[model samples]
Target: MPKIYTEKHLLLFLYNELAAEEVVEMNAELAKNPVLFEQYQHLKSGIAALDSLSEEPSQTSIDLVMEYAQKLAAAEVANV
Candidate 1:
C-alpha cells in the first residue's frame, strides 16, 4: 500500500527531522502528489519568512538586561 503523507509529515520533512529513508520517500511523494507538494510549498514559504525575521533583540532590551546584570553583580559584590 502507498503511504498517506500528511502535513505533519511534510513539516518533519521540511525540518529534516525525517529519517534518511523517509526523506527519500517524501521527496518522491512531493514530486508525484500535487496537493502534498502545494502544502509543502506553503510550509516552505512560512519557514523562509520566519527565517527572515530579526534574529537579534532590540537595543532597549539589551540595555535593560545589561542594567539588571550590573545591578545583580553590584549586589553580589556588596554582599561579599
Candidate 2:
C-alpha cells in the first residue's frame, strides 16, 4: 500500500487508530520525514487535550452563534 502523510494521515495518527500494517509503514515514513513527524506530534497533543466540544452544536446553535458574532461586530463598529 502506498503511504502518505497527508492531513488525513496525521488525524488518524493523532487518535492512535492506524491499522497494524499501516502503523509499521507510517513509523518508517516518520523516520524519514522529520517535518511530518513534528506535525504528527503537534496534532497528537491537540487531540489529547481537546475534549468533547459541547456535544456537537446543532445547526441552529451554529447559526445563532454566527448571528450574535456579527451583531457584536456591527455594534462595535457603530460605537467606534
Candidate 3:
C-alpha cells in the first residue's frame, strides 16, 4: 500500500523527526506531488524566518528572571 502524507508529516520531515525510511519516502513524494512540495516550501520559509530571529532573550526579560530568582534564594536563605 502507498503511504499517505499529511502536513504534519511534512513538518516532521522538515525537523528530521521522520524515520530513515520515511525520510526517503517523503523525499520521493515531494518530488512527484506539487501540492506537498509547495506546502513544504512554505513551511521551510517559515522555519528560515524563525531561525533568523534573535536567539537570546531580551535583556529586560533576563533581568526580570534573575531578579525573581534572587528574591526566591533570599527567601530560602531567610527560612534556613
Candidate 4:
C-alpha cells in the first residue's frame, strides 16, 4: 500500500478506522518512513491531548440546550 499522505488518511490510522489489513500495511510503511513516523508522533500527541479534554458542559450551555430540547418536544407534541 502507498504511504498515507493526508490528514484524513492519518486520522483513519490514528483512530483505528483502518481495516486490519490496511493497518498492517500502514505499520509496514511507518516502520520504513521517518517522515511518516514523525507525522504519526504529531498526530498521536494531538489525539492524546484531545482525549484529555474535559467533558463537562458549561452551565449556561447546558441550560440553553435543555430549554431548546423542551421547546422541540412541546412543538412535536402539539403537532401530534
Model 1: pairs clashing at backbone N, Cα or C within 3 Å: none
The regions of model 2 sitting more than 4 angstroms off are 52-80
2 or 4: which has the higher lDDT?
4
Q: Relative to the true structure, how large is the alpha-carbon lDDT of every model?
A: 0.90, 0.81, 0.90, 0.87
Candidate 2, residues 1-80, lDDT tens digits: the string is 26556968877756678898888888889889999888888887777667644477899999999999999999999999
| TM-score computed on alpha carbons, candidate 1 | 0.72
Worst 10 residues of 3 by lDDT: 1-10
Q: 54, model 3: CA deviation in Å?
A: 1.5
After best superposition, candidate 2 residue 9: deviation in angstroms? 0.8
lDDT value, residue 13 of candidate 2: 59
lDDT at residue 28 of model 4 (Cα atoms): 85
lDDT of 2 at 32: 92
- Which digits, one per residue and each the tens of the lDDT, describe model 3 over residues 3-71? 777879988999999899888999999999999899999999999999999888899999999999999
Candidate 3 clash pair list? none
Using TM-score, rank the candidates from best to worst: 3, 4, 1, 2
Q: What is candidate 3's local distance difference test score?
A: 0.90
In model 1, the worst 10-residue window by lDDT is 1-10
Where in model 3 is the C-alpha error above 4 Å? none
Instruction: Arrange candidates by lDDT, descending.
Output: 3, 1, 4, 2
Clashing pairs in 2: none
